[model samples]
Target: MSAIIRTENLTYTYSPDTPFEKTAVNDVCLEVEDGELVGIIGHTGSGKSTLIQHLNGLIRPTSGRVIIDGQDIWEKGVNLRDIRFKVGIVFQYPEYQIFEETVFKDIAYGPKNMGLDEKQVGERVRETAALIGLDSALLEKSPFELSGGQKRRVAIAGVMAMRPKVLILDEPTAGLDPGGREQVLEEIREYHRRSGSTVLLVSHSMEDVARFATKILVMNHGSVFCYDTPPNVFMRADEIAEMGLSVPQITRVFSLLRKKGIDIRGDVYTVDFALKTINEYIASKGSAREDGHD
Candidate 1:
């Protein structure tokens, strides 16, 4: 399958030629396949935010290229507005981006910008709102009047209304209670399931990524550290820790178990996988003992 998004030697520098000049992203090359749920994790200042902004043309690279559908997004005459429509991004605290008075208008912002008519825009708004569990009645109320979680839903619905082919979310679950976080993450998961769109989820939580992401991308010091399946990435737990990141909690538990001479896989990143591995190990041990007794 072809890549939906590809970045080649992409680098971005801030305040170039000045004392404040700094490279936020450096020679980062990566590919995200169509219909993938990719999780991006990194330490602070690792360029996760800067890298993602390039995907949607929110920021241009000082060097290198961001290619979408095999076309260079920054090529002369490329319609950047159209590119933004195809690649929707919800930044950290996306709620701050909300400016429309009513929830309906806020959610309709993207569709309207796409030049859809009232009927199409309203339909898209309602559909996306429903997808994010927003009530139709709440659509008429001001977004500021909603609860924190509701505000997040409205913000997410705003992006989903545009129905982008590639949806990028940055820290979608930050500053929320466990219930709120789970709700938002689950809605994102369901959105991916139903839309079949490529998703880039930039999060700090290894457990969340381990549970949802099809693949994990680790960034360190403005470069691509590792891009692989969760299990493969977690297998480098020591390296990840050295870089100031970590694998999931259960993965650490299993790793500890292995150190204690238990015959268990240390690479399990989720509780469910850990349980399955442990149960299988116990069953094998039980069978061996039974055979010896026989």
Candidate 2:
């Protein structure tokens, strides 16, 4: 598939030319293919937020280019509004952005703004609400009355209603209980599977990313530290850890076993892979003991 989102030497600085000037994203370049689910992870203040904002033309880069669908988003005659519609962003704590009285209206907001007729907007809202697992019974109730998780789901549904070709979610599962987190992540994964939209998910949890992301993008100090498939990226566990990021728990477990002189592979990154490795090790040991006895 072609690259749906690409950035070239993208740089953004706050308060340029002032003592407070600081580069939030510095000379970063990356590409996201059509329908690919990418996980972006980094320490706080590592420019993960800054970089995504550029993709949708929400923020102008101090230098460099952000190309969406083979077009430079910032180029003259380009409609930034159109870019925003193509790339939907559900930011961190998106629940705070919900202002409509009812969940239906809140989710309808984006579709409404796109000039969809009443019937079309209603259809879009209901379809997205269902996709996000929001109950139809809650559609007319005030969003504020809903629990925090439900509020967040409503917020996500709003973006989904827009039918963006590329969906970017920043910290979608943050500030949720474990079950709630899992629910939201599953909803997102399902949405991606059903919609075939290129998705960018910013997350802090290595386990969560490892479980779902087709690829991982690691950032450090406003620069791209690493970008690769989950297994390949996690294989550089030591390099990632040095960048102030943690590897998945399963990867760390295998690494610990290897360090303690166990004959095990340290490259395992997922629980399923770890279990398979353990079984293989056991099988090999059993075969060795049988041969020795013979």
TM-score of each: 0.96, 0.96
Q: Candidate 1, 132: how far from true, in Å?
A: 0.3
Superposed on all Cα atoms, model 2 deviates from the true structure by an RMSD in Å of 1.3
lDDT of each: 0.92, 0.92
Candidate 2 lDDT over residue span 185-255, tens digit each: 99999999999999999988888888899999999999998899988887788788777788887888887
Please report the TM-score between candidate 2 and the true structure.
0.96
Q: What are the per-residue Cα lDDT tens digits for candidate 1 across 1-294?
A: 999999999999999999999999999989999999999999889999999999999998999999998889999999999999999999999999989999999999999999999999989999998899998999999999999989989998899899999999999999999999999999999999999999999999888888999999999999999999988998887788788887788888877787799887657888888889989999999999999999
Model 2 residue 12 lDDT score: 97
Task: Count clashes in each candidate, considering only residues at least 3 apart in sequence or on different chains.
Answer: 0, 0
State candidate 1's TM-score: 0.96
